[model samples]
Target chain A: MSFEVEDRVAGATERLLGEGTPFTRLGVSEIANAAGIARSTFYVHFADKSDLLLRLAARAMDDLRDALDRWWARRRSGDDRALTECMLRVIDAYRAHATVLAAVGEVAGYDPAVATVWRARVDRYARRLRLELEEDRRRGVIGAGLDVEVAPFVVTWSIERTVAEHVRSSSPTEDRALARALSHFCRSTYA
Target chain B: MSFEVEDRVAGATERLLGEGTPFTRLGVSEIANAAGIARSTFYVHFADKSDLLLRLAARAMDDLRDALDRWWARRRSGDDRALTECMLRVIDAYRAHATVLAAVGEVAGYDPAVATVWRARVDRYARRLRLELEEDRRRGVIGAGLDVEVAPFVVTWSIERTVAEHVRSSSPTEDRALARALSHFCRSTYA
Candidate 1:
């Protein structure tokens, strides 16, 4: 699909999923209606609902990576405010794509393609975290006894879980509190 | 359904899921065939596949809770070895019922019944962790500045994500190592 077409489909998917419908039970006609395209036109861009989901899943990951990259670039100077802002921005991006993230997680084991994308994203994030930790260690911000491998896993998994909980919770304030607590924990645990 | 019939169907469901065959695609018929029961007999016990899943999800939670309870009881006096054993046992129980747990998680948002069961189980576990944390706080074993609510969520979600990663990993040794590292992280974080 062309970039414009893919962007349109992705926008429609975000709206549809944000409406909180069961994606598995959604039909082509529904997606077409949601996208403001003819049912026949839907087939021109995708094979079926699953195909659309696969595309959307890929898009979500790419969008997430882009967000992270932007955050990393914007925070290259490593000020505390920059770091906190970047982390919160990343969390917000995840929240915006929460439904798709949850679906991708659910199917990670059953779908090889999805699992590969998911694992690759996780590994990339882990590497980024490892680099950050190594920098901190070199600067004597963190204890020398920190195990490099385990620290990354802990940070990645902890951040992921914190975001997942925030997305699933009903209260926005709770999520804010959670993000603050997690940011503090991350700094304290590592530093 | 009679108690005996429910028990029989539950056993059959457990067996079919444990096998993890392509027959999963055929749904209830495959389960019926594996159980040596007729389709009508299957329906007599479960209203539908979701009903069967509800039973299985409940059973998985109960089994996990029982295992944890037994482990906790055995370690009521508290020792490092007992703590390690309890953590491993919990991870093992999660691995044993991963499929059902995954299914429950997938359907949770769409199905109120399934969501209720899942939330209840998670809440129960969280409550247990809270009690333990409270005891530790009273004993001055953990830091005074800890946020009580956030601590349990962190510990619970961390262990959960660790077990999930362990189940998805190809190497058993890596899984064990991750589990051990997670247990260690929990000890230090909580302490």
Candidate 2:
């Protein structure tokens, strides 16, 4: 697909997802109409709605990973504030594509390929956290008695679920407060 | 609607959901056919697919609450072993209705009513955990300085996200292991 076509589809996806409509039921013609493109043009870029959905979902996950990596790179050593900011930034990235994330999470059960992609993405994120924890353990900053492998899962799930709830919340202030509280909790417990 | 008709619709809902089709797109006629009833009969019980879905989602949430309550009641104090068992049971209950939970969580964005119901249900569960934590604190089993409200949200979301990832995993044993580790981690940190 040309960059222009991809941009149009991305725009249409953002509009449709933001509308919060029943996305699974969105007709091809409706999307084409919304994109101001011919029905055949839609097929040239994507095979079907499911294909388009997978592409959107993959993009969101990749974007999330990139955001996390960038956040990690900018963090200063032994700086709790920077770590918290990094975590919050990652949460913000997830919030940017909340609708698509929710939709992908929902449809994962029905599509093995999508489920595999979601699982792989989650594992990759968890691995990065695990590496951080391992480094902390090596420095004796984290308790040696703790199981390093399990710590990442615990921390990742805690952050993921908390951020998910925050994203789903209608009140922006409440979400921000929860994010701060969660980041504090994780830092205190782990640091 | 007659009791028998309601039962049939409920039964059909279960069957259709079990088949794992997109819950929002499951047609009234399909449900009616699955129930061996007239296509018009579904209308007698449900105003629309959303109505049926809401009811199913409610029932699933209620079942989860009951299971949690039962598990909590069966436990003797804050024994780590008992807590681990209870957590596993709760995870099992979630696994049984994983599809519905995922569907509801996904569609929550499109429907504020559903999102409200979900938030309330989560709050109720969190409140129960908070009460338990308070009791533990009073008994000197947990730290007094802990933020009781935030802890409940953390624990609830951790278990929920763990079970969700577990249900979606090809190797569910990882989830069980994580749950065990988390049960221990939570107990030790707060104890």
Candidate 3:
């Protein structure tokens, strides 16, 4: 029951953020009201707006990590269709939470705590890519001369920034094409 | 001259943003005072803070475009040193305007006008890369089947996002290595 209420609050926040309302404009009362809960109920689940945002971002991160795992698995299996599916799933997440993510991206600029947390998320993704790149390089699956450290950083940020920009646009590129192209670039660049 | 005052105002805004002061906290009177100008003078130039930011972003975009042009020239001439120099120049511009850019980036989330302008800048950069990629593909420079439309989008966002994140970092990666790695990735990806 607690988790359900928390999910409802999270969903309400995401819906609000997704509407192009500035994160700053989102009040706790509004969120609680939208979630059909008492204002006091919001405080029970989260300390503040930032805390709520952190929880929302954490959920998105988990979904994103799941998508990335699929990418790794499909790529390892050499299944293009599965790889593209994974990419689309990730892109869909970006599209679904475009406003929320954009708000978070904006806050990271001036908010040190947010910036640290955001960078840590990217670093976590990069760490996984680095491990794969190292293994690939050792196995002669990719060029030996590629900068192992930098390659993963670029790949992770490339997809990240690209998707972020895509979601922000009113007319985003077709998802399948973006997925195919992005996956192709990462594969060719690293593999 | 008016231009000199505008530059001072722009510099002050960048400094203020870089100091982690939210744009909402920056008053026009404070801006004018920081620029050593009368509040009236600020109005004589910029209509509002957004106008000042657009000017700042325009300047950064110009410098970025110039650096990209150098990249094209050096790559065509097969001058690795020149290529690295151009990349370093671009990186330096990103670092110098990091705060202004970050502030602009933040505003872009909820402000349709800012978001449109920012995307246009990225689109313009992507357009140039597209044309270049087409020519390169026609000349058998890169693989023929590479997605011409999508490749440049990825490349432009890759550089734009990478540099933006790089500038935001407290412990930024060494400029030279970042330059080399980024240039190498773009060159290899598109050339």
Candidate 4:
């Protein structure tokens, strides 16, 4: 019941975002109006706007992980286009919720809780990347010269910052170029 | 006359930061007290906390570019240790003003003007990296397969984020390791 209400609010927020409402300009009352819930119900479901954004951002991160998994599976199967395919999926995942993610970036500066949550999630992904690199080394795909220790931080944070910034600012026409850049970055660095 | 006051405030802020005061917790009066200036003088020289941080961050970025130039010059002279030497200097440069940089990251999330200034400067650096890549590719230092379009974003932002996070959170003992990782990352990827 709670998630249903949250989903309604999230869905409505996304629709409002689709119409081009800046996330910072959005309010609970507005979200409630769009979600068809009482303004007070927003409190029952969320502590505030940042709370709602945190939940949504978590969902988005989860989707990105799923998209990454598809890429990993394809790579293991020796698909040459694995990185490119994965990046396109990841870009779409971010594009689907660019506004919410931008809000997360905006709020995360001053909001300690939001920053902590985002950092923790990104750290987990970095660790996972490290594991993947270690496995690749064992499989003899990456050369011994690869510094698995630091390269994960390099690739993970670079992709996150570059892709997030690209999605937030660039025109949709440049998505393919950005995606190509991203896939090429990862392929040359690790593969 | 104005530059004198700004430098005083920046120096005092750095000292207070050295003494372990959180930048967000810092106030105008506190800064005045430390700088030996009137509270009203703070406003005369600066607009607000975020404004002051932007100026400080700009200075820091300038120092960083200077450090990178040293690396570039050293690399031009065929110094194999150019990147390692450069990262050590860059890390020291950040450590000198780590607190100010952290505040910039914090406030930049919500402050549109601050975000814009910071983004423009970073964008300029990314362009510089792109130019550098083109030069390297022309010189045959990097391979033909290098995607000059995207690799600049990869190296520049990746280096910035990884080094900043390390300087902010990690121990001094780990500095050498981090520097080594950064150097190896650039060397293997580019050289």
Q: How many clashes in each candidate?
A: 0, 0, 0, 0
Candidate 1, residue B9: the lDDT equals 69
DockQ of each: 0.35, 0.34, 0.54, 0.44
lDDT of 4 at A124: 83
Error of 3 at A144 (Å): 2.9
Ranking by TM-score: 3, 4, 1, 2
lDDT of 3 by residue, A16-132 (tens): 876667786678899999999999988888887777887778767777778777787666656666777789888987776676677677676556667788889989999998898
Give model 1's DockQ, 2 decimals.
Answer: 0.35
Give a tens-digit lDDT track for model 2, residues A1-191.
57788678768877887786656556888888888888899999886677787888877888888877865564325465676677777778888888888767655645666667776777888899788777777877875446788776677767766776768654555554555555555555453
lDDT of 2 by residue, B112-147 (tens): 677688878888888998888778678776654356
Q: Which ten residues in a row have the lowest lDDT in candidate 4 chain B?
A: B72-81
lDDT of 1 at A160: 74
Q: How close to the true structure is residue A57 of candidate 1, measured as C-alpha lDDT?
A: 79
Residue clash pairs of candidate 4: none
Interface RMSD of 3: 2.3
| The best candidate in terms of DockQ | 3
Q: Order of all candidates by lDDT, from best down to worst?
A: 3, 4, 2, 1
Worst-scoring 10-residue span by lDDT in model 4 chain A: A71-80
Report lDDT (Cα) of residue A54, candidate 2: 84
Instruction: Give the winner by lDDT: 3 or 4.
Output: 3
After superposition on all C-alphas, the RMSD of every candidate to the true structure, in Å, is 3.9, 4.1, 3.1, 3.4
What are the TM-scores, per candidate, against the unseen true structure?
A: 0.81, 0.78, 0.86, 0.84
- Docking class of predicted structure 4: acceptable
lDDT of 4 by residue, B1-191 (tens): 66888889999998887676656568999999999999999998888877788877887878877877676555444454666777788788877767777667656655678778877877787787788778878888886656787677667777777777777668878787777776666665553
Instruction: Encode model 1's per-residue lDDT on A1-191: one tens digit a residue.
Output: 56676567668776787777656545677877877778888888887665676777776677777777765565435455666577677777887778888667655544556667787888888799778767767877665445676667766766776577667764555655565455555545543
TM-score of 3: 0.86
